[model samples]
Target: MRVLLVEDDQFHASYMEDVLAETLPEVTEIFHAMNGEEAEHEARALTIDAVVMDLRMSRRNGIDAARTLWMERPETRILFWSNYADEAYLRGIATIVPEDSAYGYLLKTAPRDRLKLALRAVLVEGQIMVDREIHRLQRRAASPRNTLDDSEFAVLLDLAIGLQDRIIAERRGMSLRTVQNRLLSLYEKLGVDDEASDAMPLNKRVRALNRALVTRTLNIETLETAQRDFDRWQSTRKRA
Candidate 1:
């Protein structure tokens, strides 16, 4: 398999190349890029089987580049690598990629073997591998406002991410009062009577809900796979 790797850090880029070469001997060729712009250009220029991208970059950012690649190369698989485990990023990416595609979002600190496994799963199974932390975050976002309409769910997601009502309203092109009212309704549905209750800050409550969602969405088999992936990651770290 041919792969395109986009990462700015020299050490990580080199280390990843070495690991992939040693682990997946079938990866015949690997192309490297130092930034998002280069990645975007290379992605368009090459006939790569899959892309391994770093999220943080000096220009464009991984998500933007991934979106571009997804639009331009619908058949190419994308594997996102980031240090952040933010839910908003996951949701934003999900909005772009189809569920059937070979896509994955993983933490930069993930074990090398787990990274290899994620790539294999995408290439072989066409499954998207989400970092467990991201799955947890999504579950949290989904849980807190299960009764929320689509708009309300969007609003709550923004709220949990610390977006102000006015900012969210402007982004959604709705009035601030509408946002407030939606939040009030959501609180009622969640049975959260006190807005300032210690038991449920919007962020904390959302995270808890996300954990629950991950549990519900994953079956025993998939859960076992995730555990094995994580275990592989741990083992790689120990060796390193």
Candidate 2:
């Protein structure tokens, strides 16, 4: 099987190369790419059956690359290898993956055998795989399983995208008062100080967003997904 290895770190790239060579001997060609943009270019120019992608990188990330790659060819399988089993990453993965796509999310700390197994599952069996730890985090984050109700979470996404309360209410079919109330609840759940204290305004959404980001509740992938959704919503509204 021909594969594309997309990683930014030289050492990790070299390591992945060795793993591919040693573990999957049937893998005929392994293409190396430094970052997501390069990966996109190579994928467009080459015949890649599967891709082993790193989640974080400079310039562009694996999620962005994978989205574009799948857009180009939805049948290509993918293996996401990352050090972080972050819920944000898992959330982002959910948004970008094509319908009925075959993709695996494996931790970087996983053993070689585990890695090989996940690779084969995505590449051959067309199954989805996730590290148990990450899977638990995702499960725990789902509604009723954790804090933040759907309405409040919707407010969070709107806030993360820098939407005004009025616009958020309009988009979500909520009253302005209801939107503001949800934002307050979201702030409490996120442990953000949303009250005015002469230091910042009570409705300082920017500060709240920054706090959420530091807490890993809002990640780059989350932001990108939110932006995409917002853009689509805006476009649909325009047409209507």
Name the candidate that leads on TM-score.
Answer: 2
Lowest lDDT 10-residue stretch of candidate 1: 217-226
Could you tell me the TM-score of candidate 1?
0.63
Note the Cα lDDT for every prediction shown.
0.69, 0.83
Which stretches of model 1 miss by more than 4 angstroms?
Answer: 136-150, 153-180, 183-240
Error of 2 at 117 (Å): 1.4
Query: Best candidate per lDDT, number?
Result: 2
- Report the C-alpha lDDT of model 1 over 89-134, residue by residue, as the tens digit: 5655676785466788988788878887877777545687887766
* TM-score to true structure, per model: 0.63, 0.81
- Local error of candidate 1 at residue 181 (angstroms): 3.4
lDDT (10s digit) by residue, model 2, range 1-240: 899999988888898888888777679999999999999999999999999999898878888888899999999999999988776777677767889999999888888888878877887678988877677665565444236776887788898887889999999999999998998777776666535577655555877787667657668876876787799899999999
